[model samples]
Target: MHGLLSAYSPLSKVIRKKGIPYLCSPMPPSTRTPYTGSSRKLVLAFDVGTTYSGISYSILDPGQVPEIKGVTRFPAQEKVGGSSKIPTVIYYDKAGKVRAVGAEALRESLRDTIEDEGWVKAEWFKLHMRPKAITSSNPMDKIPPLPAGKSVVDLFGDFIRYLYSCAKLYITESHANGTQLWSSVERTIDFVLTHPNGWEGGQQQQMRKAAIQAGLVPDTIEGHARIRFVTEGEASLHFCIQSGLTTEALKSGGGVMIVDAGGGTIDLSAYGEGPTKGTFEEIASPQCHLQGSVYVTIRARTFLENYLRESKFVEDVEAMTEYFDKSAKLTFDSNPLFIKFGGARDRDPKLRIRGGQLTLSGTEVAAFFEPSVSCIIRAIKMQCMAAKKPISSLFLVGGFSASEYLFSKLKEELAPLGPNVCRPDSHLNKAVADGAVSFYLDHVVAMRVSRFLYGTKCKVNYDRKRADHVLRFAGVFNDVDGIPCLAGSFDVILPKDVQVSETQEFRKHYIQKAFDRIGLEAATSLIYCYRGALEKPLWWNGSSDFSALCTIKADTSKISRCLKPRLTTWGQTYYEMFFDIVLSFGLTELTAQIAWLEDGVEKRSPAKIVYDVDA
Candidate 1:
């Protein structure tokens, strides 16, 4: 509940004093190496965005470098001329069956049938799966409700299956001996799914489950291991590298920041060159903002609703908004724009409607884009300040970055800051998809920064002298050892914004005292993610900012044999066992393991991670 600035002051000063040597230290080369596996394998990357989605894949042949390719051709989109993405739209019939998807949902021929059949159209359903922390800061009224009888996971599963089909067809038709090539590696293909930077372990778990439901992988441990995750920010970084967008900045030794301005979230991440060649290390914790291209359309809708409230065409506002989004939103600049809302007979001079066309002033259009532009600027400034080194270049790439006004505003406002802003000449919408492939192949990022304080709640020895401890008298309880203890004590395993290497493991030892030997046969650690501003929180205290992230449970029947029974001062028998909860956060998803020493030798067991049931 305290000010965050106070906690960051000391760390900021230390970072400034030490120059963050960890960020720039020498690291082992993660440069793109030839595939060394025994046989041929395929790696597919899917960017299932809120408004659009794309697929990128690589065929890994032993001793040969993998090549990344996009699924350029999709059903109902053959005439689009090598389009790298398709609309993230779906229509469901009354029986909860998928009637249409992607580009097929937009076909003009199905319009009448869709309306007459009462099929529900779903768009921006990905936003429903976004972390609660993000939805709390953004308005949810603009987000449409999911179709009846369909969960967000079902939506994801359906879309993923569609994209998977597209990938299969593209690979089969585009390559030489295409049919044989696909059939050869169909059983063990690996998948890399990209998500916004704000998504965490719980979101990743849900996505994994959806993938299983879609049959991209099986519902088993090995099948789960085949799917990997990468954030949009980091994936964009890899895409920039593959496109040769950051060559000069990497050579200059200054940090580089990637602003992935997509449909639903604008993700920002900063990175610096490692001491070794072709190695990158995160210099600051990544950030994701809800202000994106879709929000601009929402703002425009809000404006039209108010402006047309007194007119007879108020019922037509939704149609007009959709038309504007498709026709004028992306191409609008400092020019008068017109939106066709009705026929020639629907003329109204007062409302600037003539011949069915509704005219919009350039200023009014600019107002709709102002909030998203400002959000990007503020996020960029925050990243620059938080980065360990000076950020010299900013790479802007995403579906939203294609907007001239958004890009122009960002370049103009950021010019004074000295970082050169650049957007690749290649397809901006394909960044995340392509970058995810690069992430799987190049593996250049050697380290990452933790975004939250991850820890577990445990009982701590009670201190009667502390005022905070006395305030929670009702929650205090005596352990089996007859010692006063307070539950809900936070034991932090990793602090926010700290640099962690790929192989880094954080461990916190804990002891459990039980009355009988049966209780020591197994143990479960409830991990909680703290989002509050406090630097070192002492207790959970039922704070709103704390959520149970996951539970790590392991069988301790073997380790329990090492414990010894003892008697407390009150003549009660008790048994105690000690173990460490180990966590790794450097990868895209968090992993947990339990470790305990047995007979002077260390033994480890894989602990099953169970996320919040309601998540």
Candidate 2:
């Protein structure tokens, strides 16, 4: 029955678009344009976080003061106005309708009644969507259930839709007076959805589909609207760049690490520059998903639950559950337990549990999640090593990054590295989303690439217990002149960390000698393998191999043929590069050329080519 329903689902039909469109509309005549050279326009940036989401618009006009809203700013800046932090929560009412979202939703979740009348609060929801978590058989079964027959996906989609509607309403209210930022109704309301770097292709596609279904796009309204996906870490980097961190880092070409520790996940990325001309490069991509505040909170909750269980004050398990829920509702200021855990008082306090009262210390609460905290530190160290660069400075962002305990722990762990570690001036929660907005505006054509390569094949050692595969390099080739290049004979273009794009050409110089007069016979035997590094070959292990054997007619007129076929890596790079190239040629996705030929001859052949390394 489940299989039957899954077969009929819309997941299959929702195609992934290769590129995002850039929309620019004319400004209205009423408002005074900021620049005399170019028309002023506003771009809306939305940070759709796991625990909180916020939207802000930026205008190119110099006179405009962009209003900061939601949570408070760090360092208490005079110019920074409004709340900068929004709780990442969505609450459903008794009628299965979205009663509140963000901060309000968080407040509502504190009430016990919110949980009774089908009022659901999604906490650490994004974490549950991780690949490992989602692939689990009963991932959602452990979580609290919602309305009749509603899946986690459905509930999440509904909540997101509500958030989108609220964001739209906020935009509408702000622009009600026909302000300069929203003067041009045509393109004034573009939104950018920020996501984690680790989101898989399927997850991203699902989010896009959900956004469309939620009527978040302009198409859902009477006119056109634009919605874009921006990586959260990248967005925060943009914010840093805009705030002059990029300039400072560039001047010295010094290495810096940016850590975005949020409710759902912790993201870390490192940047540095090449030796000559200070050619900037992102040394390490965002890693460290386990370093989230949710884990810490869960650890605290577990300790409290265990304490309650041992105390025996509450006889029934159901009653204990209620107590746990109530205990979770206590804020740092209101909850005596939180105050004790936060080290506000000197001695440990006893809390009434299932049978009796148990005394616990702040140190004990902090020690409960030491393993999780260690995982974060290990991740940071791994990223630093992968970077192969010296770290000169470290910057922390996100809600969890602001935690005194987390900050102190990171400092203590990283103290030996002797780098300047500090937090950003802006609120950590809003940093990524805000940065992403600024990045989208400043670097409209920015593209990120991940490459895979094909190389020589050899026997690999397999460990059954550990499930590990170790690669062994067989041999190296000196030349390709007489090399009867068979199916498996290939090399990876860019290794694991090497970044290549569609617009950027990757070519391997191949020289082929006509062996016999066969009309495109052996030419079709040529197979191209796209891989990251040249050390390991990227051959398909099963039926759908990309290796192709090309057969070409041996004619004296076309004796010397050199082929430079453009290869595309799968995933984000392929989509981005393809879009850019197509747009550059003034061609749409439908109109793009699909076939490639060497000279005038058509290289028709089966894509799958099998080859024996010994042969």
Candidate 3:
């Protein structure tokens, strides 16, 4: 790995000397264009949380402010809890068919007593996709095997398909009626999926494939329903900032740590004000872990089942759980949660009933909440430690952020550290979904900090001055003329935490030796990447830190007719093909172009990132 200075310094001078054409041109100009979709354009913002999901949309040009409609138009409408979101639970039958989804699944479970009916109900399935989420710190950390004979991705595809269908139906029906919509009548519906900030390209690919299968995104050259992904932390930040929910953190350059505590994972990202107002830049690499509000529910459920199965008010455990979630979870009080049951105090003296209300011991309530509370605090501490300056505000928003107990505890612990804790009063329920619509409109984040070290695999010559002599024996090498050429080296092109802007580009040249470059066939380029801050990680075969981030290929059919193969002085014969790898990083996703810039007419080849499975 290069030193801190080398990681952040200008790369043109150093890389140019290595025969790599690093694009060091200054960032280009910018512009914003309003939606051009016909008389009315529909944008769908979908948030698939761990325990809940929400959908919201904006019209092309609906007055001065766009009306963000909730998902009350969908099935199980009454179970939406007066918002766009619904439970992320699904029920399946033994024949691998979906029995019910969302609130319907819960309703059916109690209506038929499915707990003993041999029916398979899956909940909190989102926890399985998070990388390294299962741990022993909490009792509910484990993700057991699925009983539905389907992968996590398969289940998620079904859910996403359902959401897309609802959005399509709404848009089609609204326009069918002679409605005077915002845009011209010749536009298409665009879809945006909001996910946790910690997800990598692998998860993104899984989601893309699923969306394609769901018919939301057409698999065609002129792709219909252009798809976009917005991270939950960034989306929540946009929601708060756009709604004027951020006050103290908006000051000049005060740092604000945004904690998105959803149902499954809690993600943290610190941001500082950009050059002007209403703009921001990432100040630290994001952090995430699977400690969410669902764990609290798990703790309470276990205690209830063990101690109160005989209570009359808790005859239906499903109803009892729902009551605890909707009525008691958000109410803030030092007193223990008490449910009103019939006057039966003499049946069990241990079940304390004050005025006929069964008292859930305060100790029980604290025990269920302490683990999640501690995890959230630790996550905030990590972001503060990573930030360049003290975090002046802790912006808390998400479904879990609605908890008064969680909010009060975080305020008490974080106030002393630096910033004031803020929980938006109105949008806490659907902030991620709503903010994603804002993200699609404004594209609030102009700059982002790369979380992983982006690089490639290459070889370097062994030298007595800097190269270790053990490399001669341990590392793979080829004898070039008498000197050893060390192979299997990690060449870092972009270091982690470096702020990458949209205008900047990085270009490198690659020449293959003796691989029959002129075969007039296919070509491939393997782009290696790692997550840690290791300066120069060796491309060891079995190291988990290093993996192929993406595989891109180039075309040589038009390899300049004048180009010739080179015969080395080392008595080795090889075919040399020279082409530059162009990288553009100005958008939300990293993209590359394998092309030749000749006479200002760029000739492009096939260069798509390849994904792999590894959890």
Q: Which is the leading candidate under lDDT?
A: 1
Which candidate gets the maximum TM-score versus the true structure? 1
Tens digits of per-residue lDDT for model 2, 1-615? 000000001111112222211111121122112322235555566676765666655544444423223223312123346465455566666566766666555442357767566566655566555544212242122333344544445555766665555544555465545443344543444556677766543354456556666655544433223656666766676655544454444345567777887766777777665332323346664564654655555555555556656544323334433333334222221113322122223222355221232344556656644655676788778877776467776777777665655666777898887655666543556787677665545432222334223222222223324322223123323211222122323344334465332244333333233223232123222322332223554443423233321111222222223422322332111110000001011100001111224455543221222232111
Cα RMSD for candidate 3?
Answer: 10.5
TM-score list, all predictions:
0.92, 0.62, 0.82
Local error of candidate 3 at residue 541 (angstroms): 6.9
> What clash pairs does model 1 have?
none
lDDT of each: 0.85, 0.46, 0.66
> For model 3, what is the error of residue 237's alpha carbon versus the real structure, in angstroms, after optimal superposition?
1.4
Model 3 weakest lDDT span, ten residues long? 1-10
lDDT of 1 by residue, 493-564 (tens): 899899999889999999988988789888898888889999989887677788888899889888887788
Off by over 4 Å in 2: 1-41, 60-82, 93-96, 106-116, 133-157, 179-183, 186-188, 218-225, 273-280, 312-359, 444-494, 505-535, 542-615
Q: Cα miss at 570, model 3 (Å)?
A: 6.2
Clashes of each: 0, 51, 12
